[model samples]
Target: LSTTTDNGTTALHFASVGDASVVLSYLTELSTLKEINQQNYYGETPLHWASFTSLAHVKILLKNGADPTIKDSKNNTPLHLAAQAGNSDVVRFLLEQKLVDANAENSCGDTALRVACEEKEL
Candidate 1:
């Protein structure tokens, strides 16, 4: 139950970052569903890392009860990170969540839509 890296990142975070779906599945079985949303030292949850990289991991995390609205230390939600990363698919999935705040502003006062627009010009 105490397994984690120096930054407090769990195996789940590594699984999400590496796109290790099978590892994620097994980890979920061993850990509680709440662990799926555990944050690291940067206050980034597994979903936050997955949001920019894998739509499949995003879906899996959400399905397993990851909270999309949980903010990081910078007050950036999963949707916020997805938008900043220009991940349209992950943004769409996060928007579909009943708890998602589309207009939620981060510490910088940037909403997901605003970030998406800015990212488009880059």
Candidate 2:
């Protein structure tokens, strides 16, 4: 279950990136919290990828102990990715949870709102 790809992408990372809810559920259930929150070579957690997908993916990730506040190599949180992807529902869900730091800045010193405005039409 802890196996990863050449770049350190785990099963959980693939599942989250593909928005495979069923696989995510199974993997999260079978994996430990550390495994669920495992960072790839780029320092991104499964939750980070999930944020760029759907709210369903984000929900499953969070419910299964994926840390939303974790930063990637670029210092971007899950919320940062979600906002940049124009996923308002995912962003809203994450904001409501309050686990993520809404005020977090990435390596470029851009907040999620700044990323949102710059990346999306919002």
Worst 10 residues of 1 by lDDT: 25-34
Residue-level lDDT for 53 in candidate 2: 79
Give a tens-digit lDDT track for model 2, residues 20-48.
58988888999999999999999999899
By lDDT, the best candidate is 2
Model 2, which residues run further than 4 Å from truth?
none
Superposed model 1: Cα runs more than 4 Å off: none
lDDT of 1 by residue, 1-122 (tens): 44899999988888887847877766766777668888889899889999878888887777788888889999999888888888888887777765598889989899888888888821
How does candidate 2 score on lDDT? Answer: 0.88
TM-scores of all predicted structures: 0.89, 0.95
Identify the leading candidate in terms of TM-score.
Answer: 2
